[model samples]
Target: MRTRHVHPRPADPTSTSRRTMFVVLLLCVALGSVLAPGLEPANAIGRTSPAATLPSQDDGSSITWSVRPSPTDADPERPNFGYDIAPGVTVTDSIRVRNYSEETLRLDLYASDAITTSTGALDLLPAGEEPTGVGAWISLDSSELAIAPLEFVDVDFTLTVPADAEPGDHTGGIVTSHRTPGVDDGGDTVILDRRLGNRVHVRVDGPLRPALQISDAEVSYTGSFNPVGTGSMHVTYTVTNTGNVRLGAEQTVTTNGRLFFPGRTVTPEPMGELLPGNSLTFDVDVGEVWPIGRTTATIELTPIPTRDGDVFDADTPVESASVTAPTMPWTLLASLAVLVGVAVLWRRHRRRRERREAALVDAAVREALADTPNASDGSDGSDGSEQDGSEHDEPQHENGDRDRAPDGTGAGVGGAHRSGERRGPPAPRGNEQ
Candidate 1:
């Protein structure tokens, strides 16, 4: 057997291990690139996330950055850019971005529309969503910029109001952001965007009709069984901004009825701000009220021009709404039921007493009738002694025959028999024949 000298094949280094190491190194580099940008202070981005004033400062280990509106901006102390503009007009403004950091910094500029959050606070539009309001009208001079350390740049922008813009307040913002490439430990790449913005408030001037309407008026009552106890009354109404200007309302709710004479007043929660065509519903609770019968609840609203600080005319009519609801008198109803029951029982007792008295009278009358003498019986109107004397005086006959007494009266048969028996010895001979 020619066993060829089997030269031991040097164990080839497993390619799997080398490949694993290479993948890990690549992942580490990518992760570092992704996370390195976040190492900076969050304040590097200004405080304009939600209606922040300008001159916002950010301090780093060896750097400071700031973003703000130019000094020439109106109402610099406020967080927003306020302007009274007319349709078909164009306005110009500027923003300043300063890099005090030791290293160069890059920034991206953008404009976005303002939107009201679910909690009623205002905020900038989300990324990737195109703006349709004032943001659509703004044009930035440059979208990208790079600044050397300790340097600053002013970016100019223009706002052109369309002729058909709605006559109301339009809000938007100018934003600056720094984006960096980042890779996570899982090897996923992402762009980290750190952004900040300054608010812009523009009012399109036109026919500013300030009007409010009250609608959907409702009244509810919670009753108590205690006649004198207090109950609860709730009144709800909706306040709609029916005009072109924003407004706040001073609301008063009044209830008048038997439960509350004169009237009961309730103050609802303050309606902070209402934009055009917006509506807010209010619920007013009035406790410790004695409600009875019908109650009329009225809501009155006094409009206050707050958005533009305009003076509301004193002659403006108050917006009012009313609703009526019937209240049940449980206590009164229970008392009436008790009274009715008592009346029915009393009536029944009276009837029973009358029936008993009538029955007794009938029994007494029957007894009297039974004891009365019969007038048809033949009897002389004389005492019993007279009748006996007449009968005894009548003569008796020897043959036991009695003569006819006057007035066609004769002794009863029994009396004749008794007289015959007492005359002994058959008429005693001398009285015969």
Candidate 2:
């Protein structure tokens, strides 16, 4: 079987500031010494003590230290301990613990099973916690050590895999701890146990099944108030390492709709190494997305080996999950509602005004028709216009009869002489007759 090892970076002494910190371990009647939340032991020995977190002595002296895999002739720059051992096999290794303080220090050394914190950082089980895996298989050369100031110790240990050890990866760490007396804010005394350790990965020869699962996939949309503007989509899901081997993943999030609206793809940050049974959640946002009523979000994960040279099928199928959500433009709908209401009101007002104008014209025409005299009622000659015409015609015919002579021939030039003779002498009338 081929073997592979992952190398980690060294601890930086100046990574943290120099502040006097303390971890107060509570003494329980049944639990003995129980560690607090922040004081939880870590597995990555690369965590160097910032003199600030270490307890100081009466003389203002503090102990600063670090631990890592012991350097060997074959691999002088070895950062952490890694091994590919078979079941029932025995392997021997060593760790180097260095004290950077001016005072001599006494420390306790032990091994613990590896655990990952809630934030995905690698940690180790507390010293008070029992180990059921590789941590129990290894035996340290010495559990206690007294090192001089600025000096280092190379502690050797042997690991014997159980005859029936399960095949796959088993992780743990070798930690160095030092306890000192400290005063709490209440003027009470407490013991501060400072720890530093390097991670150990032991992979037993066996069938490696690298798998991942995506669950609780969900999508939500935030729509814009602007009718023509686009909205944003939020996608959240959890990724779980369901296989025995440590694995990493590359994720691709895609969002699409029913319409030909172009789909959007988002590639979030790469995920860190995930140990078996460990899970991590991711939240991603896709902006500038038009609300097409309904949208589908799909997540695709491609598995990656944390350690190089670790062979698995290259054609492993990609794990995928999908969820759909409604993306309705409620703001736009409200705007449309307001516009429709105004249009309806305007239409009603226009109809009312038109009805009022038609009513006024009808009233004016009725008044004009009532005030005018009825020409159709002429049965009674009491009509003033016809009475006046009859009176004038009668006077004209009587005058014409009085002015004419007895004989129609006596009219004309003799008419004037006959009228003068009747008023004056008979002689003038004889010539007229």
Candidate 3:
């Protein structure tokens, strides 16, 4: 009875075809899994990676630093970075920095633009070495300080409260770096950067400090390392007093050393105790500004009836600069030439001395060779003497590093002595009559 139904089941070719198709599809998926990583992402299949999308930290740029204060004035101990300063005042702030890189880097500190170009010292600092801790620069100081790798240091900056400094927040930043710094990304060019800036809110009460005025403060030749009569900048301060008491105050100013101005000490004068409504205006010279791009100082002020150091506090910063004064090629070349000359001269001198010593040994060795082969008495004394001579062999000189012979003559020893000694015993000296 079951035989009739069994004979009806024919070969299902459609089912076999479907099974084969599924197996082929599975193989393709498995192959893709192995090769997918080598293939580009959907969006990047035909294009190159965008530079913006890539990291460009220390690829080739130098490392720079922009130390910022705690954003506020709960503590005004930072150099030139303080709180509300009166129109007639100055303040000082300090910053700490380090080169968190493998190679050595230099750190330079500077201030930048204020309300007006003339408002703060905008001296240009020359490329110099990095610093470790608190350091100062001025228009008159050498631009050759340096900061070693993996080392940190402090830098002091001053904030100037112009006798007529504008009332309200004046903002700027301190920039530090090397002419050739190693970027954070371990690049070839200078790229390391640290920036710390704050907002300066100056309030000037017409009576305490007034005049919405401006004054020119000049810091002159500060140190012994200037080009005689060079390196000086004219700074203008904005004065504003929006307080109740006739305000007497202190302020700190900062600038770029070497290129801007440095040696930042500030001086503030009283606009007199206003009857809480009257205002005063004037200008006081801070100190010498280094030839940096930024310069600043701190000065203390006492209103008609004020106390010492308890004066108002704030900072006057000259924020930024246009790419106007690029360092001259000749200047850079000159510096390079000097460095090369020093290095070359030192090397040449060393080579010259080495040659002279080598020649003396060559001559001595030749003589020893001839004597050793024939002499029958190869005694211990002779051997000891030769050893002593070898130990003492050096470029002989008479009191100085200049190459010389046993005699005081400044000459190389490879050739025969000019005295016609014929490379033999420094001619036996004859007792003169």
State which candidate has the highest TM-score: 2
After TM-score superposition, what is the CA distance of residue 175 in candidate 2 from its true location, in Å? 1.3
| Model 3 regions more than 4 Å off | 1-66, 70-80, 114-145, 177-433
Tens-digit lDDT track for model 3 on 191-296?
Answer: 2222222222233423332212223343332332333322433334444444443243344343444533235444443343222222333454434443343344
Q: What TM-score would you give candidate 1 relative to the actual structure?
A: 0.57
* lDDT tens per residue, model 1, 1-433: 0111222323223322455445544543453454543442122122243321111122212223466776654466554467899999999887777765546667778888765443334556655678988789999998887767556787888999999998977777887776556555666665555556777778898766778898888888888878666577888777777877767778888777562344578777666666566677777887766656777788888888766568767786778888988766777788889999999999999999999999999999999999988876636573434332223434456666664434467633234343223322222222665
Model 2: per-residue Cα lDDT over 134-208, one tens digit each: 799889999998877767788889999988987778888888887665444455544566677777888989888
The CA lDDT of each predicted structure is 0.66, 0.72, 0.37
In terms of TM-score, how similar is model 2 to the real structure? Answer: 0.75
Model 2: number of backbone collisions: 2
* Model number with the top lDDT: 2
Query: After best superposition, candidate 2 residue 227: deviation in angstroms?
Result: 2.1
Show pairs that collide, candidate 1: 34-182, 34-183
